[model samples]
Each structure stands twice: as C-alpha cells, then as structure tokens.
Target: MVATIHVPVLVREVLSMLVVRPNGNYLDATFGGGGHTRAILENISESARLLAIDRDPDAIERGKQLAAEDSRVEVVQASFDQIADVSRRNGFEQFDGILFDVGVSSDQLENGRRGFSFQKNGPLDMRMDPTDGKPASEWLNTASVQSIATVLRKFGDERNARLIANAIVRARPLSETQELVELIDRVCKTQEVNKHVATRTFQAIRIHVNDELTQLRQGLRNAFELIGHAGRIAVITFHSLEHRTVRRQFSQWVDSSIPARMPIRGPNKGPMKIVERGLAPKRQETERNPRARSAMLQVVERVQ
Candidate 1:
C-alpha cells in the first residue's frame, strides 16, 4: 500500500483536548487521512468504538481499509453535516466525543489533479467530492462578475474582490488552474507578507464550490445534538470565516440563546460549554508544518 503523506495538523493538541476515554464511543467527523482516527484508536481501549465519516470517496475508501484492519473502527461515506443521520443509521445515538478538522486536507492540496494547489497546474475541479456538484471551472466560467466578487469578498476576504472578479469574468472559460492563477497575479497586487497572490481567490473558489460554510453550520448543530452529556466537540478551522462561525455557534450554545429567534425555552440551560479560549499551534508545530500556523482549535463540552 502506498503511504499517505498527509500529516494531520495539531494532532497532539487535538488529542489532548478531545480527552479520549477508554471504551468510549467517538466520531471523527472529517476522517481525511485517518490520522486522528488512528491516534484515537491507539489511546482508547479494545472495547472502544470509533465512527469515521468523510464526504470524499477517496477518503472513505482509505478509511474503509483502515477500519478493516481494526474491529473498533467503522468508516462511513458521507458528509459531516449528516453526522446525526449517519450515526443514527449506524446504531450510535450519542457519541462520547466528536472532532472536526475542517478545510481542505493535505492530500487534496498536494494532489495537482484535485486542483487545490495554485503552484501546481491542473484542471479547475475543486470539489471535495469530485463525483458531484459543479466544478470550479464551470462556475467560474459561467458565474456573473457580481457573483464572483461576492464569493471572493465573503469567502476569501479578498480586498480586490471587484478587480479580481472583473478579470475572471473577462477571462471566462478558464479550464486550468494556472490560467486562474496567472489572471489573479496580473489583477491583484499581493501586499500580504509570505502569502501568495492567488491564495485568496483559490480559497474563495474552493469554499464556494464545496458549499463549506453552510455544511459547517449544519455539522456543528448536528454534532452538538448528537454528543453525549459531558462529551466534547473539538473543531480546528484554518480561516477566519470558519473560526468565526464556530465562535458564534459556541457562544450561542454557552449563552443558551437561539440567536435572532426566541430564547431557548426550557429548563435546560444549554447543551454546550466552552472548554477553553481558541488555541493556536505552538512554535514547534508551526515550524514543522507551516499549514498548522493558521489553524485555530476550539473545544466545547456538552452539558445538561
């Protein structure tokens, strides 16, 4: 078997915050390369069980192989947003802990064919699940300038959203990754130190193509409902958008306010409590894996 080069970011910190329990049942909601799943299996007892879920078919295949080797692991092919349904169908009503390592995985980024890397030339297909949804190229070629600008501003936080969007619309029918990169490089001046000129555009496109933010919101809600009392949920997000969503959701849970709707009506105060302030990678980890630099981990425990 070929080895997976994907090193899970902040593995040690994630494990520490997860507080794996012997014989406990857990869920690895993102199960990218099974790094976190393997660690959990090692730390827990033989009686412990873990349910690994991933939307990517390739990831599911890898997860199935991993599960075949260990009786305690069960791999499911589904998005993390469907956690509640997947777990229910799998006979797990509540999980002792749930973990989400959001954003694109290393495997996706490194594989040029996946079209996630701006440095590598490839087709403009950025869907996490290549089997479905509109490819980035298709959307980029057909989407209006205003729509493209909106995505860049909302998802990528690109300062030159209008300029980049105009350029992209003008250069429609972009079929390759390099084409888009070159266009962005020509249109936007990169002032951010150590960041690529195409970074924001690529990020914006990928997030939009994958419907990531919406999925994350749903996943968080489902995960909270499915966690057992005293169980914890840890999320590692790489960008401001994701981190903001998690922070708001966690705050709502802590404050027991439904937000924009009527206050949570019940004797129950809330199901979640923040375990700690947002945590970032230490100098050592970031030095080893630069990708870990932007990662922010936040943990919350479910309480009655």
Candidate 2:
C-alpha cells in the first residue's frame, strides 16, 4: 500500500482534547489517509470503537484497509452530511467524542489527478467525491460571470473577484489546473503572501463544486445530534469561513439557555459548552508540515 501524504495536523492537541475517555466510542468525520484515525485508535482501548468516514473513495479505501487491520475500527464511505446515517447503521448509539478535520485533505491536494493544486497540473475536477457531483471545470465552463464572481468573493475572499470572473468567462472550458492557474495569474497580478496566486480561485472552485459549506453546516448539526451528554466535538478548520462557521454555531449552543434549534432530531438535553478555540499546532509540527501552520482546533462538549 502507498504511504499516506497526510501528516495529521495538531496531533497532540486533538488526541488530548477529543479522546477524553480511553474506551469510549468516537467518530472521525474526515478520515483522510487515516492519520488522525490511527492516533485515535492507539490512544483508545481495544474495547473502544471508532467510526471513520470520508466522502473520497480513495480515503474510504484506505479506511477499509485500516478497518481490516483493526477490529475496533469501522469505515464508512459517506460525506459529512451522511455521517449520522452511517453512524446509526454502524450501530453507534452516540459518540463520546467526534472530530472534524475540515477542508481539503493532503491526500487529495497531493494527487495531481485530483486537480486540487496546480503544482502538478491535472484535470480541473475538484469534487471531493468525483462520482457524486459535477467537476469544477464543468461549472466554470457554463456558469454565469455573476455566479463565478459571487463564489470567488464569498468563498475565496478574492480581491479581484470581478476581474477574475470576467477573465474566466472569456477563457471558458478550462479543463486543467494549469489552465486556470495561468488565467488567474494573468488576471490577478498580486499574490497572497507566501501562497500561490491560484490558491483562492482553486479554493473557491473546490468549495463550490463540492457544496462544502452546506455540507459542513449539516455535518455540524449531525455531530451535535450524535454526541452524548458530556461528549466533546473537535473541529480543525483551515479556512477563515470554516472557522467562523464553527465558532458561531458553537457559541450559539453555549450561549443559549434553552436548546433552541441546536440539533438534528434530538431530545437534546441542553447547550454545548466550548472547551477550546484557536488552538494552534506546535511550532515543531508546523516546521515539519507547513500545512499545519494555518490549521486551528476548536472543541466543545455537549452539556446535559
């Protein structure tokens, strides 16, 4: 088997915060390459069970291999929004700990064929699940300028959203990462510090193609629904929007005295309390895996 490209960011923090109980059931919502999943398993007991899910079929394949090796591990091929169903089907009554390492996985980003980055220059397809949705190229080739601009602005926070959108419209049918990267360079002359010029554009396109934000929202609710009282949820997000969404929802749950709409379909006992926010990776980790530099972990425990 090929080695996993993912290095598992914030490993020490996630293991300490999320795996509060050594033998409790847990869930790893994004089992990319099984880094975090393996850590969870090692940290827990032989009696403990872990449900590992990822929308990417490659990740699922890796997960299945791990499941075959470890009896306590249960692998599921499902998106974040489908996690609850998979968990129920897998026979989890409720999770003692739930974790989400949100955003694109290193497995996807490093695979040139996945088209997540232009460094290797592959197809323009950016769907997390290549089988489920249309490719980014298909959307870019057909979407209106206004729609593209909106996606760039909202998802990428691109300063040159309109200009890039216009350029993309003119350069329709972009089928490769290099094509889009060159176009982005031509239109947006300025680059983000220490980042590629195509970063925002690729991010926006990938997010749109995968319907990531919507799925994240639904997934957060599903996590809440599946967490038992005192159970904690740890979310490691790489994007500003993703971080904000998690913080806001967690804050709402903690602030409200009543349950309000804070569930999926639960006899939700009460609000969720925050355990940590903006927890960063150790300097050693960032030095080893630069990807960990921008990642942050937030944790909240469901209070009954």
Local distance difference test scores for all models: 0.87, 0.88
lDDT of 2: 0.88
Compose the digit string of candidate 2's lDDT tens values, residues 204-287.
Answer: 888899988898899999999999988999999998999999988887677544333344244544477677867888898899
Model 2 ranges off by over 4 Å = 256-270
* lDDT tens digits by residue: candidate 1, 1-304: 4246778887888788785577789999999888989988888898888999999887888998898899998899888678888999998888888999999888888889999999999999999999989999999999999999999999998999999999988888899999999998898766689889888989999999999999999999999889888888999999999999999999888854433223345554666667755899899999998889999999888767
All-Cα superposition RMSD per candidate: 4.0, 4.1
Residue 264 local lDDT, model 2? 29
